[model samples]
Target: MELSEYCALDATALRELIRTGQVNAAEVETAARQAIESVNGDLNALTQPLFQSALDHDPDGPIGGVPFLVKDSGPFARGVTFTLGSRSIRGAVAAVDHELMTRFRAAGLATLGQTTAPELGLSYATESLRYGRTRNPWALERGVGGSSGGAAALVAAGAVPLAHGNDGGGSVRIPASACGLVGLKVSRGRTPSGPLAGEAGFGLIAEFGLTRSIRDTALLLECVSGPAVGEKYTLSSPDVRYTEVLRADPGRLRVAVTTDAWSGVPVDLQVAGVAAEAARTLEWIGHSVSPATPGIQPDDIVEGSMLAAVATGAALLRAPVRPDPGRLEAVSRALLAETLAFTALDVMAALDAQNRLTRAVGTFFTEYDLLVTPTLAQLPARHGELDYDDPGYSMRDWLRRIYQYGPFTAAFNVSGNPAISLPLGQSREGLPIGVQLVAATGREDLLLQVAAQLEQAQPWAGRQPSVFAG
Candidate 1:
């Protein structure tokens, strides 16, 4: 297959072609490599190239032969450098595959290489001193949202069809919104996290990926989802596969719509308008849409998220190979110091607050089937818009800035509910505008059904980025 033809197919379509012998795995891998070489220089998406290693993947595995990129943060493959977008761990290599990585390989995905992430996956924008900035494929001057920014950029640019990403406070969905892709963060414990750390971001982080098509996301979710042994929280398996769920209709439902940022930050008019428009679309599809938000305070979410993040950060800093203070980013160092100062009582208080908020949001979901909101408070920010290195920056200032950009997303992370960002509209400048559809915890099936409905109603497949290979 030609590079153009290869780039055009999503993971599901590519898998079908390989299954039918219409195209061989090697041909597809070659097409992916050529596509990456064509655009990665300008985009700076892939931080490493594992072309030879990818070629060694099992060709007969399910969805086998599809080129995939793993974010450099946490998805580890044995022998591959696992830089968490920090200079401290530059030469570090994973001795074993992460559980998610093992599953990805087992499902027949060829690990092409690692993509860039913000240092320690702390920031919402993928601009790290370690690997430089990952620019959006639609506009070079704009930032691709992070910590899944590099993966989103590669997929948006057509360098790859699907790429691994994990979300703790909007890491996956933020970039998916910026890049015009499907990004789903599953309910907590729906996927495994083991053999390295028990849970990431104190259970706020969920492992997943960004894809151009909803079916690709569904197929991957089906492939990698399941509880590992001794998992603290185990969710019951879905009665039907997500791949089959896409064809089913989500009955007319009650959806709460909110343009207001939970943080009380003034949302950009255009962004809010787009989200409101999406609500109208849902109404047209026979769902009851109303302007209602969860009865939780923005301050509670901010505090809870910071508490979890700081604790997680402190734990990570305690790794066997201690990082040099000078080598760490200014914000990372500052946050680490701040977290180190936190007392046990303070940590417990934060956890208590998070649990309360989670329960409150859960209660709200009992009244509504889903919640609709602007995935972002505004359009994608310009490169260097959010400063993480300034010594004067406080945790509060940082939260305010990030929440302004991604107010709707972090709450779901805190609540451990299933949320997805769908590219439903575009700004006047032509940047993608994504609207989020959030379902109660363990309701990915409902979210996917609604998402597939939206995808069919307004398809984004024809939209191409400025840096696309085709």
Candidate 2:
């Protein structure tokens, strides 16, 4: 298959082609490898390319024979180097496949390699001492939102149709907005979290993927979603297939639109206008739309997210793969120091804050079926702007900076609500602007329904970045 042909086909389209022998698996895989080679140098995507594994992958799963990239910071594949974008931990490899990784294999995805993430996924930008900045394809000088930055760039640039990424404090959605992709942070308890442990980041982390289209997003969810054995979370899969859900009407949804950040962070007017326009479009679609903001304190999210970082950092440090202090970056050193300083009671208070915010946001959802906000507060920032190496910051400070840049996203992450970022608008500079649609917990089915409708109403297929797979 030609690179242009491979890039043009989405996961669903490519699967059908291979399934019918119109295209062979190897041909698609080769195209993907070449695509990566063609763009990886400029985008700094793909931490490691495991293209050889494409040969032996199972060919009998839904969406099978599709090229996929896993985030370097997550869902460890057995024997693959699970560098959390850190220079430390020499020779550390995943001893077992995470439940998600197993599901990825079972779903017939050819794991091409790992994409870049921020060190420990702490920052909202994918720049670290381990792997340098992952540049946005939209504009080469801009940053790809982290820590799923590289995955988003790859998918956005059409190197692959879909790539695995997880969100805890907007990692997936942030990058999605920045890269103009479909990113969904599944609700808490909706996916697996065990085998090595029972839970993650005190239920803030939601493992999912990013894609170029809503149909691909819906299809991928059907392929890899569902709880595994001993997993901490267990939500029912879409009652019907998500692709089927996409076919139906979303039906008279009451949507709340907010240009004002609940965290009191500033939202750029251009980004806010795009969100406002999305609200208007929803109203035009026969849905009720109104301006509203969740009643919550900024500290609730900042504190809760920082505490989760503290917990995740503590766990990683205590594990056998602990990094040598000398090998750690300044930001990481500051993170560890901050983690050591935190008292257990402070963590309890953080949990209390999480509970309070979750309850407050959940209360807001009672009146509104959906919440629309800018997926990012500003446009994709220039590269080197979200500096991770600065030792002057603690985890809380870092959280504040990143969250302020994307105030709306973390609230949903902490609330455990399902949120999707769609590329619905473009800036005057031609950069894609993402509008986030958030649904109550475990409402991914509804998210897809509305997302598909929006995708149909205002198609983004005609737009491509300055740098694309072709």
Candidate 3:
């Protein structure tokens, strides 16, 4: 098959082709290389190519012969270099495959390359002083959201059907929304973060993928969703496959739509309108939608978490990854310095606050099965729009910038719930607008159910960016 023809098929379809003997793993890999050569000049998404490794060993499973990519950050890929979007760690190679990569191999998905991430995935956009920037497939003028920006871009451009993405604070979903794909942030510990380090963002986050289709997302989750050895936490898998849930109808359930941010920031009108449109679609599909507010108390949760995150961010300055002095951007360095200024007591206080916030969200889910809201308060940001180049800014100001752009996502990290950003609508300006679907802790089944229904109703798979459509 031609490169464009291979890129056009979803992972499932590709697998079917391979199983039916119509295509082979070598052909799929060739197609991926050709696709990358054709599309990556405009996107700058792939950080390291693994075509040789994939060709050397092709396993058989659910996604066998399907080409894919992993985010440059999080865990380790054996023999492949992982820069994590920083110049500091350039040329570093993984000594062993992370457990999730092991699962990807078992599933028969060929990981032909690594995708771009923000420097250390510290911020929400994929622009890095180290690697330049990852441009959105929809518009070169705008950024693809970081730190999974590369994965989102490749999937959006049809270079590959699914790619690895991990969300600490909306990294996966942010890029997914910005580039128009399905990004799922699995419940913390629901997906293993091991074979190198145990947890990241102090267990406030989890890893998964940004996929062009919900079924691809579901299949990827199945392949890599269980806990690995030495993990402190693990969630029970559903009795039936998540793809099975997609095949069944998502019966009427209570759905809540909220446009208000916990920090009192107003959602952009276009984003809110997109969420409303999704709500109407749910109603048309036999689900109930009503205005709902989170049950959590709003007294300093966002601020407190930001302060705590500062301490965690500070710890990364001394991280074991190959240090790329002068490789990271000034914003990351400034943020790290700010985190270092905090006392150990401050971090403890933040963890306590995180517990309280978790309890509050847990209480809310008792009444509502899902919460629907704008994935981002604003549309995709311009390149360097959230840059912290000003030396005069305080850590508090930096935190404000981060929180203002990503208020709703971090809360779910603390709560350790599964939430997804679905590219259900587009802004009048032609930017993608992702609507969030959040589920209770360990209840990904319900979340997938809702996603499958919405996916069918709106059908984002057929919608492609102009670059790829041609």
Candidate 4:
């Protein structure tokens, strides 16, 4: 098969082809390699390409011999290069396969490569010191949001149909929103993470993937979710598959819409317009939508959660072969330095704020089944907008800018609730604008139900970027 044809098929279609012996896993692997070689130069989204392992794997398998790519920010495929976009650990290879990745392979996904990420998955935009910048597929000058930014860019560019992503603080959703893909941050503990690691950033987050199709995302989650042996916590699974839930009627949902950030920060006009359109789309589908704010003290909580996140960042700096504290970008180094100011009590305080904010949002969900908001307060910022170039601002100011821009997503993570970013609208600049649909903790089924309805209302599945149009 031609690389173009192989790159075009979604995971299910590829698997069907494999099962029918129309194509072999090796051919798919070659196609993925060729695609990466052809486009990665312009994008800089790939960190490691594992073509040989894919050739050695099964062809007529579940992922149907489809080639898959993973984010380089996290520890996943064993013995693979994992540089979380830092110059410090330029060629660090993981000692073993992370548990979630094992599940990916078991489900018949052939691992052909790894994608780029922001440094330590810390930034929202994916301009890393190690690999330079991962450019957006739609518009090269704009950034793909980080952590999962490269994965999102690759999927958006048609380099791959689905790629792994993990959300600690909107990492998955941020890129998905920016790139116009279906990015689901599954409820915490919904998927097993083990062997190589257990629980990320103090159980504040977990990892998953980004896909062009809701069905592909739903099926990927179905394959990945469920408690692993010896897991500290697990969520209750629905009796039916999430894909089925997508087709199922969501019933009448009371969805609360807020154009403003939870902290009362005004949203960019285009961002708000996209979110309002999504609300209108919900109304078109018989759902009740209204302007209502979820109660959150954005400042108080942002400080605390940020401490936790920066503390995680600090730990990475203190990891063996620490980046030349000087070599580290000014912004990231400042963040790590600020984390040093936190005491154990400070971490506890952050945890307390997280719990309180989670509870406050939970109360809103008690009255409203869903909360809808712009995935970000603004469209994807130009490259270097969030970079550490301005060393004058303290770390807190830098973090506040990020918080104000991304207030909606972190709350769901703190609450351990499920949220999905649907690419239902676009900015005037032709950039994709995503609307977030959040459900109560463990209510992913219902969230998918609403998303599926939205998908049908304004079908965006075929809206590929120019690169992917081939």
Candidate 5:
């Protein structure tokens, strides 16, 4: 197959071609490599290339021969360098495949590369000193939101159909929104987190990926869902496969729309406007839409996140290498220093607050089937917008800035509800603007149904980034 033809197909389509012998696995891998070679230099998306490893993929497996990229931070594969986009742990290599990685392999995905992430996955923008900036395929000067920035950039630029991404605080969704892809953050226990740590970010982190198609998202979730052995938490299986659920009717959903920035900072008018239009579209499609939101205080979110992050930082410092302050980014070092000062009581307080907030947000869902909001508060920021290396940067100020950029996303991570970012609109400057759809915990089926409906109503596949592989 031609490289352009290969770049145009999603994982499922590519897998079908291989299954039917229309194209061989090696041909698909070569096409993917050509696509990456065509655009990765300017985009800096793939941080580590595993082309030889990918060549050995099973042609008989479900998505066998589909070229895939795993994020560098987590969801590790054995023998691959798992740098969290930081100089502190530059040479760390994974000794064993994490359960998710094992499952990805079992599902027939050809893991060919690792994508860049922010330092310690701390920032929303992917501008790490270790790997430099990961530029957005849509607009190179703008940031591709992180820490899944590189993954999103690669997928959007057509280097791959889908790529692995984990969301702690909007890592997956933020970049998906920025790069115009489908990003879903499943419920806390919907996917596994074993053999490394019990739960990431005190259960605030959820593992998933960014994809160009809703079916690809559903296919991947089906492939990777369920608990690994000795898991601390496990969720009840969906009534039907996510792919099957897509064909079923969602019925009339009671969706509440909110443009209220949780931080009290004003949302950009264009961003809010697009989200409002999404709500209108939902209403037009027979779902009830209203302007209502959970009363979540910005300070509460900041405090809870800080506590979880500090605890995570403390745990990282206990690792064998023991991070050096000079090697760490300024923001990371400051966060570590602050975490070191946190007392046990302080940690407990944060956990308690997170629990309360989760229950509080859960209450809103009792009245509404889903909540709609702008995935981000503003358009994609410039590459250096969130300067972690600024001499005057303070943790408090930095947190405030983060809340401003991502006011709508972190709450769902804290609540452990299923949230997805869909590229439904565009900014005047031609950047993709994503709208978020959030369902109650364990309701990813409903989320996907609604998202697929939107995808069909206004297809986003034809829209290509300026720096595209084709």
Candidate 6:
């Protein structure tokens, strides 16, 4: 198979091709390798490419034999080595597959490589001292959104059909927006975090992957959604399969759309306009749409996220083999310092805020079936625009900076809502603007149905990044 042909197909199509013997798995793997080789140096998306391991992997399952990349960020896979995109940590190998990896394997995704994430998965920009900057495939000078940045870059560039990503505070969605891919952050507990921990980022993070199409997102959720054994959360499965929901009509219902950032920061006008247009698309599709905010407070996003982030950093820095703060980037070191002064009462406050924030969002659903907003406040930033290494910012200041750029996505992380960011609009300059659709907890079926409609209304499949394999 040609690299261009391989790059053109989504994971579902590739799976069908491999299964039907139209193209052998080995050939697809080779095309993927060549695609990676051609663009990875320019993009710096791969921290480690396991081409030989991929060759040896005899995948079998629903998506068997399709190329996939795991984020360096977490939910470990056995035998895979990771540095978590930090310079201070020595490389370590996982002893067992995290439950998510187990599901990925069971679904037949051939894990070919690891993508770069921000240090401790904190920043939105994938640029790090170790991995360097992971340039956007769409615009070489710009960033591909953080932590999941490299994954977005590779997948958008067509190096792989899909790649794992986790969102504690927009790590997946922001990058998906910046890179023009389908980023779905499943409801908390919809996917497992582990044999390692019950929850990642204190239940603020949801593990999933970035994809090219809504159907891919639907099928993937069907394959990976469900609780792992011994999980703290055991959400009941959806009444129907997610893929089936794509064809089902999402009944005309109340829809709420907001251009305002929860943080009360200014959203770029272009982005807000795109979000407004997306709401109009929803209205055109027969849903009742209105301008509305979820009534969630800024503290709901900032405090809830701050506590989760500080705690995560504290655990890593306090481990037996402690990570040296001197080796960390300016922002991560600031986070570590904040962890020291952190107190139990602070934890209580954060938890309280989480309760209030989640309650506020939950209450909004009483009036609306879904909410639409710009996935980011602005477009994909230029390199170094989100300076992770700048010592001028404190932990709170850093959070504020990130929240300014992407104020919409973090709230759902705190609220445990299922949110999907779609590349529904593009800039005149050609950058992708992500329009996010959020549904109440365990309502992914609703999200997918509407997403399917939006995908049809504003199709993005023909759009390709400048740095594509094709």
Best by lDDT: 6
Per-residue alpha-carbon lDDT of model 1 for 39-127, expressed as tens digits? 89999977776546582355677779899998887537777877788887756877888788888888999878889999888788899
TM, every model: 0.98, 0.98, 0.93, 0.94, 0.97, 0.98
Model 2: lDDT of residue 270:
94
Residue 366 in model 3: lDDT = 90
**Model 6: lowest-lDDT 10 consecutive positions:** 49-58
TM-score of 6: 0.98
What is the C-alpha local distance difference test score of each model? 0.87, 0.86, 0.77, 0.78, 0.86, 0.88
lDDT tens digits by residue: candidate 3, 101-185: 7777788777778888777776777877666788888988889887788889888988888888777777788888889988899
- Tens digits of per-residue lDDT for model 6, 1-470: 99889999999899999989999887988898888889998899988755476622337788888999898964377887778888887767777887888888889888888899888888888889988999999999999988799999999999998999999988899999999999999999899877778777788888999999999999888999997788886687878888888999989979999898877788888898899998998899999999888888886688899866886787787666888788899988888888988899998888999999999999999889999999999989999888999999998888889898899999999889999999998988999999999988999999999999999998999999999986
What would you estimate as the lDDT of candidate 4?
0.78
Q: Write the per-residue lDDT of candidate 2 for residues 312-360, one digit (tens) a residue.
A: 7787668865678778877788888877888889888998999999999
Model 3's TM-score against the true structure: 0.93
User: Whole-model lDDT for model 1 versus the true structure?
Assistant: 0.87
Overall local distance difference test of candidate 2: 0.86
As for candidate 1, its clashing pairs are none
- How far in Å is the alpha carbon of 232 misplaced in model 1? 1.8
Candidate 4 residue spans exceeding 4 A from truth? 55-61, 317-321
Superpose all Cα atoms of candidate 2 onto the true structure and report the RMSD in Å to 1 decimal: 1.3
Model 2 residue pairs with clashes: none
> Candidate 4, residue 152: CA error in Å?
0.7
